[model samples]
Target chain A: MPFSFLLLVLAGLSVIAYRFGVSRARAVAPGRQAVLHSRPMYHGLYVAIWCGIPALLVAVAWVAMQPILVKGLVMGGLPDAYDALPKARLDLIWNDIRNLALGDVVRADPAPEIQAAAETFRRLYTIGNAALTVLCLIAAPLAARYAVRHVSIDLRARNRVEAAITVFLVASSLVAIFTTVGIVLSLLFESLRFFAKVPVLDFLFGLHWSPQTALRADQVGSSGSFGAVPLFSGTLLISLISMLVAVPVGLMSAIYMSEYAHRKFRAVAKPLLEVLAGIPTVVYGFFAALTVAPFIRRAGEAMGLSVASESALAAGLVMGVMIIPFVSSISDDVINAVPQAMRDGAYALGATKSETIRNVVVPAALPGIVGGVLLAVSRAIGETMIVVMAAGLSANLSFNPLDAVTTVTVQIVTLLTGDQEFDSAKTLAAFALGLVLFCVTLGLNVFALHVVRKYREQYE
Target chain B: METAILRDTMHTLSDTHAPEGEAAPMTAKIEARQTNVHYGDKHALKDVSLDIREGEVTSFIGPSGCGKSTFLRCLNRMNDTIDGCRVSGTVMMDGEDIYDPKIDVVQLRARVGMVFQKPNPFPKSIYDNIAYGPRIHGLAANKDELDEIVLTSLEKAGLLAEVKDRMEAPGTGLSGGQQQRLCIARAIAVSPEVILMDEPCSALDPIATAKIEELIDELRENFTIVIVTHSMQQAARVSQRTAFFHLGELIEVGDTEQIFTNPKHKLTQGYITGRFG
Candidate 1:
């Protein structure tokens, strides 16, 4: 039977089980619902879970294991001569057999022995699926009947259902955590491979970065340099410029919106300001590359000063504009969170409006604002599209905002976008960059959390 | 000694006795005549008239939503902070119309300080919390003078001895009673002519409430004090005069002893005797 058909059958059985459980509970209680430990709805849900969960698990397991089990059975029945082939050649033959079994066009006409193996594979797969359908058909009804029999006045149907829901919620959260760990582990392993070719200290501390390695021995630029210091410096410089622009503008705007703006104005204006954040970063990239970069270069030429066409200033300025809503929204919330009582205390003491906000409200909201700014700084450092389009990929170890620079993300994108062997240091270097970026942002987030925690205790 | 005087006054309460029968003829430090307050469409405070005498604790007592707190906030124009709140009629402070256009609100607030229901200390060191008012008003000429003002304010609020060693600690870190006292000290540091307290002891325990009540009695020696309270016994203990409000109208105003013992209005009698509010 098809998987969808099996699912539909399981669903139908669960519905029947639910109705049976509800009617059975009612029949046992007659007119005494108060005597039952749980309501009729919980009893119904409990029976449905018992009916559906076991059959669903069996179907899922069979679907996962059928191909491997069928292939194993087919291989055992094959001729002994096939076992002596190398693993790669055997894998090619297995691929051909699978294609032939599915009636797909194969590379060539197969031998009679291979053709027999494909037929055997097809037969085994059919038998496994048919058996799964029969077993599920029996398992659902039997489990549901056991549940119905157990549903007495003393049964804790609510507790059992609640426990099952809790297990589901835990499983959902664990998937996210495990995926994050899986990504970090994969990055770590690939970075180790890259480090084996290049020393860790050299990659971390050396100033030069030229990642092109010639495939032919006689080709130019054969000796590729993998020093990452320039990328780090460029990332830091752009992030610094962005923060310098973002912090004051964002914090002041937050203060104005939270403390000064009229209620109707604030209601309309806040979402409009957040619209800047909602604009796709890719759009911001083109805006930087096409608009601001040329403007800065022309303005620099008018001043009789040298400026790169793709300068860090343009990207940094645009990135800062992108981050304003992030800082402003979080700061605005924290500022608004500062109790009205604090402002009242200041105003009551003969202090002016400015004094109240400066001495009391801002200080009370400082920890949250600091946390927001740090998060924005990390976002600026990791931002790829804006820096990629506007900040040229030169990797210049310069602090001047007028000069072109390439960040870690830009370098990673440049390294991995083209056709390249997976095992080469050039391709694996992207994973190494990814690992370092992850660690830096993780450190920043941890530090921001610490600052918020330490200061929040005094207020609470 | 205070309780003896309170008991003696309660026993002698009569309608014939003059309201201001004390040896010294008191003058009104703050006076309101036919004052009305509205929040949006709601008539929060009706045309209420009262006198806050100089160097006296006059408590406003009523049930919740009776406009006692609203009247207290109106004294120093704290209502201005609230959006859509309108106030009309005259409020004269020391014979000057406080609602006049020329009067600077910032300077007026400095002269008429306030303490809130809950302890709202700035998230600053205890010393800074007290010195903030003086520094902004430029009351102290130097750092030593500022320190002196902070110490004396704390001393007057009865919090100096306990917190003298930790002036650097955040005021919010103090206990509930201590934080409230710190707020009182902060108000005192400005040397305001009047202090308005809106249910200042409502959030406190009995012991903290008692301390705040005692502090209010002491503060009355220098600053005119107007307090709004829910506890009738608290009004009898701390206030020299009491005003009862019901449904946004001033029901009665008299000497605290007379109001508690021989209330003239049936509504005042009903509220004071716990018959109904």
Candidate 2:
């Protein structure tokens, strides 16, 4: 039987078990004098969990073990001469047999012994699946029957069912946490491999970055210099420019929305501001490259100044526009969170509206605004697409916004995009860059949370 | 109930007669004539006419949502901050119409300050909280003058001795009663002619309440004060005259002694005797 078909049957059985459990609970307490300890719904859930969980566990375990057992039986049925062959050749033959059993085309004509092994593999797999299906079908009803018998008036079915749900919720959250840990561990191991080939200090502090290793033994002019200072500096320059544009604009708009704008205007404008955040970054990339970069170049030449066709200014300016909503939305919420009593106090002191906002409202909301700005800064540093399309790939270690520069994210994308071996230093550098970027962003998020928490404690 | 109505009419006749009959009549610092307040669709205060006497603590006593606090807010035009709150008719301060279009509310508020039910000290240092008003109104010409004003305001509010050492500490860090006093000091720093307090002791304990009442009594010598209170005893203790409000109407206004001992209005009598509120 197919795995999905067996799962469907088990699900149907659990539903029937739930109905049976409810009826049994009703029957057990037929007299008016006898009261139930838990609700009928809890009793039904308790029986359903008992029926489904054990069968699901058995199904998972069977699926996990069947492949190994069937592979072992197939190997045993092969000739004794196969055991003397090398491990690689033996693995290739096993793969051929398994493919042939699944009715796939094989690489070459198979030997008679190999053909016999394929037949055994198919028979063993079929029998194992059939046995799993039968066992699950029987086990579900038996567990459910035991649960139904325990559904007495004195049973604490609610407590038992709630405990099962708690465990399931914990397992669900663990999947997300474990996935993050798994990704970090993989990045760490790959970065370690890259570090073995290149010294950490050189990669961190070197001024030049050229991640092209020699493809041939005697290839010339392909020395891979993995200096990362230029990329870090570029990231900082772009982020700084973006913050300069985003913070004042975003904070002013937030202040207007919270303090001055009428209610109807605020209701209409806030969502429109957030629409900027929903635009795809790829669209911003094309906008930066095709429109803004050329405009900057032409405008700079008009002023008797030189500007790169792909300048950091274009990408930084566009990215700043992209991040305005992030800063504004968070700031608007925090500013609105400032108590009305505070504004009233200032107003009663005979202060004007601007005075009240400047001296009272903004100061009270400063910590939350700082946190929002920090989050925007991290987002700017990690932004890739706009910089890739507009900011040139030249690793110029300059602070001038008009000069072309590249960031770590753009560099990582360039290093790993083409056909290449994973073992090369060029490809591994991407992992190293990824690890550093992750740590930086993680640190920023932690600091931002700390600031926001301190702000909460102030008013609370 | 019939006799109470008869006495109420008789007392109203005597109230009009006594003021003209006395040799020294108290001047009305603020006069509201035919005042009505509307909050969106609800009629909050209706045709209320009253006078807040000069240099005396006048208390407004009523149940919750009776428009006593609403009337107090109107003295300083604090109702302007609320959306859709409409005030019709005249509120005259020293014979000047406060709601006139030419009147700058900032200047009006500078002359008439208010304290809220809750202690709402600004999130600033104690010294700065008091100095905030004087600084904004340009009342002080220099740092030394500002410092003197802050010190005198704190001294007048009776908080200088308790918070003298922690002058730089945050105003919000003070105790509830101390914070309320800090707010009073902040109000005094601006040197307003009148001070309106709306249930200023509601968030405080008995000891804090006693302290604030004492402060209000001392402040009456320098400022015209209007207070709203839920506690009848607080009104009797801190005010020379008390006005009773029921629903949205002013039931009666008289000397505190007369209102407590010989209330004419049935609603005022029921409220004072704890029969029904």
The best candidate by DockQ is: 2
lDDT of every predicted structure (CA atoms): 0.90, 0.92
* Backbone collision tally, model 2: 0
lDDT of 2 by residue, B27-122 (tens): 889988778899999999977778888999999998888899989998889999999999998999999999999999999999999898899998
DockQ, every prediction: 0.76, 0.77
Q: In model 1, which runs have C-alpha deviations exceeding 4 angstroms? A: A453-460, B1-24
Q: Which stretches of candidate 2 lie over 4 Å from their true place?
A: A75-95, A104-114, B1-24
Candidate 1 docking class = medium
lDDT of 1 at B176: 92
Model 1, A204-237: lDDT tens per residue?
A: 9989998888887888775788899999999999
Q: Where's the lowest-lDDT run of ten residues in candidate 2 chain A?
A: A25-34
